[model samples]
Target: MRARDVRAILFCAVTTLILLIGSYVLLQSALISLALAAGWLAWLLTRPRMQRVIRRLRGEPDWNGYFRND
Candidate 1:
């Protein structure tokens, strides 16, 4: 895996952990934690860099013929 992909995964993991702690330990709610985590994941998925990492992890080729216009 590329450094960027590793970094992205780490970032996601850390952010989710913090959010979970804040939601349950601090705020005392599991529902809010779930919503916040889902929101964060949705936002992350919208990022182009994250999308590239996800595609790479899925073993998709970077230079597929679908990218070219006929």
Candidate 2:
């Protein structure tokens, strides 16, 4: 696999592990976990690259090609 792919996988795995640890630290409260997850989602949604990906997923065309057509 490509180095970029490997880095992405590692980032995801580490993020998940950190979230799990955060929940554990919060005494496994479902409400807290949900809030944390929602916060993360909100943060990601605000990112330019992520916005382009979301738009692409919804089949909306981006004029600037923020996300490469390739």
Candidate 3:
């Protein structure tokens, strides 16, 4: 398998393991699982690198663009 594919599989396995363990050891309620999933998603969304890549892709004007606009 390719390196990227291997990495992806490993990541997925680890994530699944973590979620399973958390659910089993902490609380078995559906609400708790849903909350954990939502919290994980929110943490991923607020990451700094993700924000930078998203802003660049959206073509938001930066410092250089601001100076040119003046």
Q: Which residues of candidate 2, in runs, are more than 4 Å off?
A: 1-22
What is the Cα-based lDDT of residue 30 in candidate 1? 93
Locate the minimum summed-lDDT window of 10 residues in model 1: 61-70
Choose 1 or 3, whichever is better by lDDT. Answer: 1
Output candidate 3 Cα RMSD: 8.7
Per-residue lDDT of 60 in model 2? 76
How badly does each model clash, as a count of residue pairs?
Answer: 0, 0, 0
Instruction: Identify the candidate with maximal lDDT.
Output: 1
Worst 10 residues of 2 by lDDT: 1-10
Among all candidates shown, the one with the greatest TM-score: 1
Distance from true position, residue 15, model 3, in Å?
Answer: 3.1
Task: Please report the TM-score between candidate 2 and the true structure.
Answer: 0.59
**CA error at residue 40 for candidate 2, angstroms:** 0.8
Give the Cα lDDT of each candidate: 0.82, 0.63, 0.58
Tens-digit lDDT track for model 2 on 10-54?
A: 654577568857886877786777677667666756767555555
| Per-residue lDDT value at 49 in model 1 | 75
Q: Name the candidate, 2 or 3, with the larger lDDT value.
A: 2
